[model samples]
Target: YKASIPKNGGPQIPDELEDPKAFKLKMETAIQATLKSEKAKGETYSQDEKELMIWYNYHFLGRGKPTTHIQVLSSVNNEQIKKNLPPVFKEIFARISSKLKHQS
Candidate 1:
């Protein structure tokens, strides 16, 4: 299965995900290359395709809580979804985690 991070309201990728090194820039480059590839140009995905695949979209919350929150949509067990349908998206920042960050 494949996943994707939306351009808007997605996780806040810092200017420097790493230290002095530019991990964010590298990540963006990789993502762009993957998105703009010939294969992608030939077959650009649409929003309705979100049904069979996993998605990560962001939203703002009020109160003392964090300003932005991440959301996930994964419910393959649902009978409404066909079991034969496979994922058809590529993950960009889906595997990111706090442990990958270096606390300075």
Candidate 2:
């Protein structure tokens, strides 16, 4: 959900979000043209889709354990997103650090 600024100093929107329609078009074109042309050996389309979903779940949802989440949130340097998230995610995110803060 966060985007690092590009080296060109342009507005930092992730490629996936920058122009979803364009991304979809590119994906469809690649699948229908390039791969078909190459006759690349790979899993079937349905199998590939399933594998992508599994990978997404593992990499995105699986890593959201509270401890890892805290570590990641604490490292954010984006003041705007950090500020915006605080009101919404504060209690959930603060459980660990707030405990430490109280103890200290």
Candidate 3:
């Protein structure tokens, strides 16, 4: 899995996760937990895909945000890894998209 520093202040997972799949799962769980906890704290839940996309952009790209097309391309560079990433990212994206589809 590709590794990069997130732009926002938050906890960072360690780099020695060994298995990328497991690491991705952990990240997904952490994101959901953070969002859910935020919502529980009386934050208005914004169900906008664009906003989630931007969150992911900030977390991954760490620079001026890129378009969805560019982000997708960059996230999946190797053909083999690309095929695998869609399924993994899709699940995470689905959860995020469901929460933030309006921003799309």
**Poorest 10 consecutive residues by lDDT, candidate 3:** 38-47
TM-score-based ranking, best first?
2, 3, 1
Deviation in angstroms for 52 in model 3?
11
Instruction: Itemize residue pairs with steric clashes in candidate 3.
Output: 47-99, 47-100, 48-100, 48-103, 49-100
Shift in Å, residue 44, candidate 3: 10
Model 1 clashing residue pairs (backbone): none
Q: Write the per-residue lDDT of candidate 2 for residues 1-104, one digit (tens) a residue.
A: 22332355322222557887765544444444434544543346664553343333333444554654565566676786567675547777788788899999
- What local lDDT does model 2 show for residue 62? 46
TM-score of 1: 0.19
Candidate 3 accuracy as TM-score:
0.22
Clashes of each: 0, 0, 5
- Candidate 1, overall lDDT? 0.34
What's the C-alpha lDDT at position 9 in model 3? Answer: 47
Q: Which stretches of candidate 1 lie over 4 Å from their true place?
A: 1-21, 37-104
TM-score of 2: 0.24
Q: Write the per-residue lDDT of candidate 3 for residues 12-44, one digit (tens) a residue.
A: 443434676764544455445445443332235
